[model samples]
Target: MCGIVGLISADGPERLASRVAAMNAAIVHRGPDDAGVHLAPGVGLAMRRLSIIDLSTGHQPMTTADGVALVFNGEIYNYRSLRAELETRGYAFRTQSDTEVILNLYHAEGMAAFARLHGMFAIAIHDQRRDELILVRDQIGIKPLYIARHEGELLFASEIKAILATLPCRPAIDPQGLWDYLSLRFMAPDRTIWAGIGKLGPGQILRRKLCSGDQSIETFWQADLTPGPFDIGRDYAREFADQFVAAVDSHIVAADVPVGAFLSGGLDSGAIVAAASELGHRAFHTFSISGDGAGGDDELPLARAVARRFGTTHHEIRMARSDYFDTLDDVVRAFDEPYGDATGAALYLLSQRASDHVKVALSGEGSDELLLGYTRAADLATLAKVERRYGPMPRPLLKLAARFVSPDRASIFRAMAEGGPGAYRRGMAAHIGWTISDAEKAAFWRGPDMVPSFDLVQGWYGLPDTAHPLAQSQQADFGTWLVEDLLMKADKMAMAASLETRVPFLHLPLVEWCQNTPMEARIGPPGQFRTKAVLRDYVATRLPDAVLNAPKRGFPLPIFPWFAERLRDAGGYVPISREFHNWISLEGLKPIVARACRNERRALEQLWGIAMFDRWCAVYAD
Candidate 1:
């Protein structure tokens, strides 16, 4: 894994080296093992290498003998296979690095080489022959790639801050992007918080011709969700288990250095360890994080059970409220954007702990999005059925009920009353319901945009072009939230600690197959209410029922209650008070803060969102 940056200028390569060097230096934490630069007449590419493979010879900004150069940031698990294929085609390679495999494959197959790739990557290949720069992100966008265009030049980087460092220009904030962040907690693709810079959407590729000044962006791939004509119903549980185990085995086998797994008390991570153990890889190292407070503590016992069962080396770290308060700046700075996910703290802590034992760690992310594993999905399905029956509710009555009712319960009623496109959009915005007032929402958001968050899901469910709702939802996520938000968090937090995180469950083939499977097939019987039912069934055979059936307590954190109780104590330490004192109404925050201290669950998430946004403004906007 590594961080890459490049500047393409029509003005020749005079300051390119110094500019690229400055950009790469900003994200040196991402790749501290080595650094390399490739400078040409009009292009400069710089890379910081973590050196997971070909430790001695894999230094990058790697170039072919013929002058084609490539800067890459990710792992190509199928490099060995691709190398063998390239060899048959008369291409010779000097190194075992996947970077070389990519350069050779590009030389041999052109853009078609992307179709053959099966790993996570964000690649920038400069074709010296064509004077063109080609940028491609992985199919699922497990890695990040950001680009900005300025005065006939294009700047690209693994992190936004790196690009900002080189240009030293602050673009206007995109209003829609700001709205999305306030409502959804993160920016969507095709939009960045910074107006001029845009994220390269997943499954998409951008190609620029330096000579002709032409640029084209297109979707190179997508998960196939069309159901197959024939049905093969032979113990899907066992078959899925076998396939999952094989996928995890393949992922772990690719690491050139010591690797480990992040073991939460949930089935996702536990299942990975169980499968790895059964695959004969003993002595795997596992890491877990726990909160010190009473309400936010973790189930370390469950994690210990899996570790003991497999006899793996287990490491646990306990973090107090003070630790979270103190590290807030580090976490916010690591993410170049204002990310509102509280789990960022937990992920950062976990990665910091894991980096001590291994260079790479297997994680269980993307499973929730692919498998309908969130409670909101099940809730949306139930509400959709109700909305179909109650299609004629008066707006005023519904609005009145929404106001008097608690936000948690009101969310359910709102979901049922607001049908069609609006329902899904509202559901998507449910997490940040505190951002706008009813009066303000009426004035600001309208038409399709005003539709509930679930409407995005509904659009997927009712896609005129697609048949599978689950698959459509996955596609939407890949386009919007997955890359711009979740993957950003994963990459930044892991790279912050100089650790590599691989998600076997996010393998393209597995996702493609799951997309085509019917929702019924994936979820099993109605009313089961068990998200990821298919995977759960697979886990049932390989893991204890307790692990498989445990409630999904996602990377738990105590931010809300901790802030409520400790805000005054953290006054001097908190980074936001100076700037936040101007815009945010602290008086308005009192009720929410009071509710959080009283242990009102739903209020806490919204309260934390406000606090996070406040701090973000202090750091970035103030």
Candidate 2:
């Protein structure tokens, strides 16, 4: 709900304060309501407040009676309960803000207090008593925290742009980070497009000791998927219904200002609206977006269906192709890094529309990750089985058959033939298959050391030292893609519009609980047909079967076709300019561009990637 920045140095206070002030100013959009700066001998803390709670008295850079100051950037939804507990222990609070509760909680319980709270946050706590600084990101990383160290000083911010403002030198682009972006569309945690700036991984707490110049960072929570067999007879449907309702109810009450939901007409968003309606908040505000062109338009009709069902105030925004083209520069700049998700366009527009009516909106983000909602999961599982069965087949015959099959069929067969957890791991890497030829890949890729998506997958599999393959993949996502990519996108885009996006499904306890539930209970009968079975059962208990059984429609956007038609006419495709040629081979991209113009879908994906890279270079490489 805010932007937090700070500078810690062994140098003079005035110099650091000036730099910190500049960094805070860069992110004023994140917290236009209020701004505060505190400068001490070796530390400076700056905060921009959105005034979500305790608006009148919640001015921050808040300190305890003992002089430990805290600058926080998100909501601790359970702050009231933590406050009550702290009050019993003789910790007197001067304000009702969650920021005060967090300060006191750290004072009373030390680092262990983190486990007792539930919410999304990125906090910078300066303990003057110990001459130490602690930075903690939320369990699921709904908030972003970036850190950089140069010349015996540490700079941290809620956005990379803030840190960029403080540093005198140009940002260093890491080749590995760029490679990751090209291969997967986004950079991974512990790595940013900038070489020196790093993201604090989710569920991680980092402590920097001033005297020794020492830092220690570690994960405090992880998903544990060791569920026993499913028992449908135990009234699980009813229990899930009750828990779902309670979870939605609690999240709805967390905001201090007028709140609404991102009603996308999908079951996830629809179910949330339906639940909120049943809770007696009759007048709910909802928002949705539709693409401008014929093929790019989405399921706004379905969104309307849910809105009408609940009788809520629904607002719709129609985005023309020209609108997307116009905003491309701002969107890339807003991200401050190369992001490949085409949905970024839709999300940015949606958040902008939502901001007009409400200060905060609930989104259905984490449900798919927690519940194995994507078809890729089932495909990978099936492919693993096939690989095991065909291990002894002749390689030449396998290759011949692969050549004859369609790309989708070949990919599944190849994945299955590869077999084992490692193979399955590689299969799930985002953007694993090449839409471009090997020649094009070689030409387009400028980095000497390219990391295969498999390596990232393998690295994730080894993160927790656990035996659960499914859980390992999920945990890897929790650490890498979920936080670094999806959540990062959500925070940046939403904050860019000065809107607070709250995801009830991403609640820490709820995510942890879902992780422990059996996969069989979550992913139903074969073929990805009955996925999110557990969630469906829960919804069935609250509403009619019609609503529960509604087809799963993800936040769909027509990016592939949009890039081909709309962007094509508007000089959206980057020409073979010298700057682009420095990294990617123009000779390699030319054919791909030609094919994309010919309406080749696969070619368009590659063209879009190049176009995005070109656009990003134009923004950040100056």
* Candidate 1: tens digits of C-alpha lDDT, residues 1-622: 9999997886546677788889999999999999999888888888999989889889888787777899999998888888998898888888888889988888888888887888899999888888889899889889989999988889999998888887756776565565556555666556677878988877778999877779999888866544444356656566567668877987888778888999988888988998899999886999988787645346677788889888999999888887877888888888876777787888898899899889999998877776766545555575466456544666556656777887655654564355432353333433312343433333433223433433333333333222333444555554456566677888999999999999988887677766666565566655555677778876776666667657777766566667667644544224354655543455555665666666676655655665676677667766
Model 1 segments beyond 4 Å from truth?
224-232, 294-297, 375-384, 387-462, 465-475, 526-529, 567-594
Pairing residues by index, what is the TM-score of model 2? 0.90
TM-score, per-candidate, Cα-based = 0.87, 0.90
lDDT for each of the candidates?
0.74, 0.75
What overall lDDT, based on C-alpha atoms, would model 1 receive against the true structure?
Answer: 0.74
lDDT accuracy of residue 31 in candidate 1: 96
Q: At residue 240, what lDDT does model 2 achieve?
A: 57
* Each candidate: RMSD: 5.0, 4.1
Q: Candidate 2 on 255-363: residue-level lDDT in tens?
A: 7788899987566787788889999877689998877653434678777877887898999987887787788788887898878777787888889988888888888
The local lDDT score (0 to 100) that residue 538 gets in candidate 1 is 68
